[model samples]
Target: MSSAFRNRRIPTILVALAAISAFCVGCSDSEDESDSTTTTTTRSAEGADALTPFVGTVHFPPVPFAGSDGKNHLVYELSVTNFTSGKTTLDSLQVIDADSGAVIDDLDAAEAHQRLQPAGSRDSADSLEAGESGTIFLHVTLDESVAVPKNVVHKVTTTAEAAPPDLRTSTAEVGPTKIDSRTLPVLSSPLRGERFIAADGCCDASRHTRAILPVNGQTFVAQRYAIDYEQADDQLRIFTGEPTDPKSYFIFGEDVLAAADGTVVGTRNDLPEQVPGTFPSGISLDAADGNYVVLDIGNGFFINYAHMQPGSVRVKLGDKVSTGDVLGLVGNTGNSVAPHLHFHVMDGPSPLASQGLPYLNDKFSITGQVASTADFDRSEGTGIPLVTVPGLQTTEHSDQLVMDQNIVTFG
Candidate 1:
């Protein structure tokens, strides 16, 4: 491929993930007696087979996708194991900017998965076996038109098995955005040049809208929530070479601070973390979200935080908080990554009883173009930093909830 085309086309594929915490999807203490030491070959895009590196062995089928730049991309899942025992260190896995060597995640694509890997696998064929078992989630984008490099490092690793943390009492509490203000608050910036409503948990852009926040400010936008499998299971979620290197992928139980302040109205903190996988073997035995919380933000509105670290929650159901408070670090106790905060805003006391509402933050900025359905050309600078992209602002006197209709006045 020409340097220019390769530079322009592929990086968008890298930044598209949303959230990939850590989890232990396929971990086993099985005994392996295979001493053959003979190399096994797997086929590549070019129809050529090669000996497998213990680190990059993949068994899941490839997922076909279309990129924001209008090219076909493929994502895959695989099992990885640490044979040497003790530990292994993964490094040098990166997706670089064609020209400046800068890295960014492929979050600009609306269809991106929070983490790579499909919903299921064929008998866990793609998993790594430590002596017998271990695992990881892999995201890949391939262009048949681009030359197939013989020794290309599609993936890399440095350790045997990364373990999940025991978060018996972790919790996270999200705060409220200013509804009675003219400005729209910062909801999410999945990656640079990528920001959107926290309404639909899915990455579908069609589901995105400026209307997520209400004009009357009487209520907040409705939000969709889902169980993040990786965190729930204790497998590390890694983003491939955008804005950073592949080595940057990580394990779970990292800290997740409170996004807002309020009294804790509800809490569920006794679920054990699961192993990573879409349909984890024993998933049906557990509730969708293992551990969660709902904070009473005064009035009828409550900030719903889900998938918290088990037992790490500092506050009781009635605890009070301020902005930036350390409610709890991230964890894979619920439907989650090894550890990450799954948050949203709703009108009722419980996730099931409340309706998702639009909201704004007290402080923050949007870093991408506010896309409208009328024009596809609106999206630009996927990885570039966006500042002062006009939308809304807040102030002391003009305190009224901003709605979707007001976007025109601000734009």
Candidate 2:
């Protein structure tokens, strides 16, 4: 459980208050004075928290890192529960720099609705019923000129006329968490070639970063920092000939390199390749990362290279590998829709259960950017040239996580 979840206390006093609070939402102004309920309460002792209408906790402390956009990003979620007895409408939120008293970001109601998804539904919403839970997806970017904060907190305010007239505009402090300061691993390139596109990658992309799954009774975003690398030719085409043929891809059978020196902890080399053009049907969860390898890259970090060519994995379990060593060849396999390398650094050996962590490429050159995921998909699915943002500078970057849609060259 998150620390914030454990710290919130609602004893008997709040339980009685919750019931009265519910009745008070629909109570008329002419109701007897004796039936009125008090909504505010404060403890007399110093540092004691008073009762509040909502509770929120951050499931994972974000590790701030610089991205290809040349800015520092803090990407994480705030899990919340409505403690009020009446329906609560989220008004707005302000992410504050708890130490410097600086306002980091202000999300209006519409923006909140776009990012806030309820517990069970995939769609986003801005309101929750009494005792309901939801999650707020947040992506905070700090400009290159600004300093990153050591800690951050949220100010959650509900809509006016929500309940208990006096508490209509109440603001509560929630999800205060210390920022993780550990340095992200600087890794060598996992692939070698020009025009290697960083698709469905970090910061705000939906396909990878927003892929949250409930596994073993806990929720995890294993692909939060994952990058699906696909290559394009000089004509900006993902494949030249038959789309179904794995050999048609520019990166097919290319060597997959170890990003860091580490001992092989887990591996699979027998899963057959899936046909390109669409996702395979009915893949079990255990086979999601088909013919893959996991490396313990020291300090509790594991790197996963998934969807490799069947029988191409060169390293076995317990085999020690060094940076730039050949691990396998990229292939279309497992839950994959096409031939691309699915790569990510996780906190655990099991790719599905661990939280994703950020990593920096030791060096790489940016070549271009795909206009959008749709454009890349269309070009990959059909034999069309990829739509790209023109005139991107081909410059080498050092020690930064690549962002979404960027076409890069690796050594």
Candidate 3:
């Protein structure tokens, strides 16, 4: 296939996550890891901390949010650094409630490796050399019967290749963090329709959840809560004709609505629509969001809408908008690979420099779900019908967040 027509996911880029700080032992770098990249915590003065060879901490204190599955989920990233002088292998990880000493969750080496990824690299994270760092993308779900913990810690077990005979294997309690107590913004749907797909959204999706990037000397996870919304026809078709034409997609020229009451803080409307099917190359950092709108929704939170149709933006800077206001029309613009509405909530107005915030939709229903992200991509690339999972009930959801690969209907 020609390079321009080759299928590539939208907004792909290389990023290096910052090393987390907690149990910094046998430290090599003198600089502090407490910059804007990670959440800073006070180190323990206990004697047992001196024996730990791995440093770890969370990027942000996670807020528990309800999902369409009727479970409370804690979604966040954990960064760890092997501060030992030799190679170290991660054996297991267990999440523990620091206040009650109760174990919340446990993962074996194989499962942990799937969730762990080295900074700026996609290699296996089962082993780490000296000074190597990796981030574990965590998605902990709790049943309605269980109570949410106020604080949590990680019990990490590892083995060092160069350690003395009696000290080769060790376990350490690291990455102490308190749960975020702030309230999540209850959002309205960004579009009103059926067969809407939440692509590259929430929880375990690496395309958005682990998209940590460095900007202006600090690393931030602006896309952590992002969701690319696309629509499909009754036959589960995302596009009917030429894949390269934005007009061929089901969601093309659809109205993009404001998710909340907010004032427009930023606007861009001059960029032309990008051809669908293949990812655009050489997109500058500034134009990656193309023809976008940023809304200041109060309490230091902002709503970002990207990949809008050229000349379709209805709101300008400083214009006050209410829920369900039409901001623009969805189009294949900027760094997009298709015509879809890219929506997210951030702590600041700057798209790339802000931290993502958790949120929930006021009402929606799960009519179905795509079998997987790969299946959705196949339908997008080949113009085949979406591969859906059977036996799923058409369940109604209210005040819950839609997860990745969900086929929802909002009104």
> What's the CA RMSD for each of the models?
23.2, 6.6, 11.8
lDDT of 3 by residue, 316-375 (tens): 999999999999999888999999999999999999998888789999999998989899
For each candidate, what is the lDDT?
0.34, 0.82, 0.82
Residue pairs with colliding backbones in model 3 are: none
* Model 2: how far residue 92 lies from native, Å: 1.8
Report how far off residue 358 is in candidate 2 (Å): 0.6
lDDT (Cα, tens digit) per residue for candidate 1, span 183-241:
22332211111122122222222222111222343222234222121111111112222
lDDT of 2 by residue, 64-125 (tens): 99988888999888888887656678878889888997888889889877778778767788
Residue 225 C-alpha lDDT in model 3: 80
Those runs of model 1 whose alpha carbons end farther than 4 Å from true positions after fitting are 1-222, 225-251, 279-286, 337-339, 365-411
Off by more than 4 A, model 2: 1-53, 160-162
Give the range of the ten consecutive residues with the poorest summed lDDT in model 2: 39-48
